[model samples]
Target: MPIDNNYTVKRIPPSDVDLYKELRLEGLKDTPEAFGASYRDESTNARSYYYTLLENHDVFGVYRNTDTLVGIAALALSPKEKLKHKGTLWGMYIKPEARGNELAKQLVLQIIKIAKETTEEILLTVVASNVSAITLYKKLGFIEYGTEPRALKIEDRYYDEVLMRLPLT
Candidate 1:
């Protein structure tokens, strides 16, 4: 998919494990409630583990003209036969400086384009309090089907998640 000239979006290959890890850590730290994994949990993981993720998951990144990775989104497809027609969009985040632009929309559109090739639908869960993110998802055709209460507990606070899906077929 073609993005703006100021930014380029592409999949993060295994060779770029370090870059992927760096971006992932930045996302986890910047928005702890946005992701399912904790910074502490991923911080201790080995380099090989990150490489494995790059190999197994369809992870995409947005890079500025200077070649700096500023955004990321990932798609994970289930292997089970019953769930093969569905995929999950996860770990989507863009740097604070890159937020005003439509980088996030482009990144997600790329994911949906790739997902439609094999999956009939895509699923995602965003923190209920993330109104902007929820609005973006809805703008991209995702509809909320349910809410998962206490989906995440960071320290003593619990965060609810709004479950959403976009049908590709």
Candidate 2:
């Protein structure tokens, strides 16, 4: 499923919400400890669950054909007042078969266009071990601001996370 250098990128629509949710849950389930919240934890809150992700967050997806969902990204505005000028990039994932293609770069590049419309900065959180994500973010103008040591834990284990930001201005 490695896509060609050329693949269609589109803004995710409401019609794609179910698939979006399914892929989101897939990412959370695959890396529960890697994310701040899990599919299990957010499954109960109606307003907070998938509404904003479906209704608010700006999304971009890469399709294999014209209608299939191979990868997706979610970039949402930061909620804090001081951070309102910033947008957060997260929920980035690609199906296992779609990993080698540049779909993620395509998604990130498109998202930067959306981020540029709002603020001077974009922020993203990545597990310290996820080098490819961090690398791509850096190439897209993000820089590592700091590290959140053991920011999340699962069982007896803890994992570090890197916080990165790109100043759009």
Candidate 3:
């Protein structure tokens, strides 16, 4: 499906921390395996922690015409000199209802646009079991570089992740 024309994609500023946090927690709860962070760990964080995330990370959000935030993606640039040319793409989530509308693609394209200005490459990891997400990343030109076995253990089960990277330069 094509992206909804009414949906607007923009960089989420720190002043909108409450909205971003709400959408983030929803993502963590809805699909725990898709994200690296667990709901248990994030739910305990204070408002300041979320605000700090906005301060340090470049977060982009997709909002519906009705003023509801439906999707989010974040880009984190490496501060160290050795890794300054690389950045990590994380915290990408789109509401279930918002899926299939290309909002995820739009969000990612926006992140990539912003990332190109500062980094030569962007890296991300998707759960091996999540074929849809992996497919999406590949469609956006992210190539798999490696895989990490048992990357995450939730309770008794383990999940593997496929590491992928897209070079901008």
Candidate 4:
């Protein structure tokens, strides 16, 4: 089913490593390739690897009925000091059954809150085919920054990626 205001959004803790791995793998396995990594790549990472992401920075998930993880969004620091003012926003997903409820907007709202508190701006790359995601980001004040042509090669075919940014000024 779908949850409205009753559902809550909370920061993911290291204890829920398995659940995090499961949902993230599901995102990677989505038919349109929702993420930069793949299921095969995740299959190689150690269990503790995912735990590190939840533990290292503040990544959160929006859950329904206190158990159903229907949506997720993350903001993590950049690896370079010069880019410290910038953060990467990614790992956004809403279960198929959870669509049409403005959940993605709420999730991004949470992410943007954190981004404002932690970084100057957020940068994200959405697969060009993901109209819904691009539209949501734009609605949240993201502007087109650039594009990556043929960014992904999946199944012998190439796909372009659109880079978008939200300046928290």
Candidate 5:
């Protein structure tokens, strides 16, 4: 089902640092293969680190009832002049309880909408085994450009990543 009016999509402000941290750590822990960052490393960082993330990236959240933040996705525009035309869609997650409500798609769509304003292309990487995410990205017009073998390693295991891009130009 589509998300109803009760769910609001908005750019997360710096004041919501704690909420963003909580949800981010949850995603990192619950799905280690899905992210490049480790919970161990991020959990050790100061609040200022997360503040910098909010300051540097376009982090958008999906809220329920105006108070509960259930999902998050971010677009990081490259700072280098040569790469500035490209933006990366990263750090996307939705709480388990909020799954099946189409929150992930909505979050990604919001990122794409914002990315178009500044980027000629939006790029993303997903764990190759995550069929659901791959399917969703394809449906949203993201084309698979390549796959990186063993892109992420957690403990003794490795996870490959599928590289995808949506051309905005």
Candidate 6:
């Protein structure tokens, strides 16, 4: 189904740390393999950590009913002088109840739009087994570059990630 016209997308500010953190933890716990960070690690972080994330990156949130945040994604621009032209798309997640409405696609397109302003390219790594996400990235013009074997290890199990990039230049 197409995204609901009522759903709105906007940059998540630090003031919405509570809402963002809740959604972030839900994603981490629900789909451990899709994200690089584990709930165990992030759940222990101080509120300041989340504050810094909102302060430093372009974190986007999709809201249902214009008030309830249901999805999130971030575009982290490299601060290093050598990598300043690069940006990484990470922490993308949509609540189970909010999936299948093309919210993820809409959220990502907004991220790409923001990234294009400052970065020469956007990079992302999605778990190899996530066919749907990989397909979505391809549809958005991301090209697979390579795979990183054992990209993430959790409780003796390993997951490989497909590295993909979309050059804005």
TM-score for all models, in order of appearance: 0.97, 0.86, 0.95, 0.92, 0.96, 0.95
* Deviating ranges (above 4 Å) for candidate 4: 1-5
> Using lDDT as the measure, which candidate wins?
1
**Weakest 10 consecutive residues of candidate 4 by summed lDDT:** 1-10
Predicted model with the maximum TM-score = 1
RMSD, one per candidate, in order: 1.0, 3.0, 2.1, 2.4, 1.8, 2.0
Residue 164, model 5: lDDT of 99
* lDDT tens digits, residue span 71-138, model 2: 88877887778878988887788877788767889888878888899877888889999888888888
- On the 0 to 100 scale, the lDDT of residue 169 in model 5 is 92
Q: What C-alpha lDDT, on a 0 to 100 scale, does residue 121 get in candidate 1?
A: 98
Please provide, for model 5 over 39-69, each residue's C-alpha lDDT reduced to its tens digit, 9 standing for 90 to 100: 9989998998998888777999999988888
**Candidate 1 structure quality by residue, lDDT tens digits, 1-169:** 5476778999988988898899999989889999999999999999999999999889999988836888999999999999999999999999999997889999999999999998999999999999999999999999999999999999999999999999999
CA error at residue 59 for candidate 5, angstroms? 0.2
Query: Which pairs of residues have clashing backbones in candidate 1?
Result: none
Question: Which scores higher on lDDT, 2 or 3?
Answer: 3
Which residue pairs in candidate 2 have backbone atoms (N, alpha carbon, C) closer than 3 angstroms, thus clashing? 120-168
Query: Which residue runs of candidate 5 sit more than 4 Å off their true CA positions?
Result: 1-3
**lDDT at residue 79 of model 5 (Cα atoms):** 83
Flag regions of model 2 displaced more than 4 Å: 1-6, 43-52, 79-81
Q: Write the per-residue lDDT of candidate 6 for residues 52-144, one digit (tens) a residue.
A: 989987999998877789999999987799998889999999999988888999999999999989989999999999999999999999999
Over 1-169, each residue of candidate 4 has an lDDT whose tens digit, in order, gives 2235567778888887788888888878885456787788887899999899899977788788777676777887977889899998888878888878888887788888888887899999999999988998998899998899999888888889999999997
lDDT of 3 at 168: 97
Ranking by TM-score: 1, 5, 6, 3, 4, 2
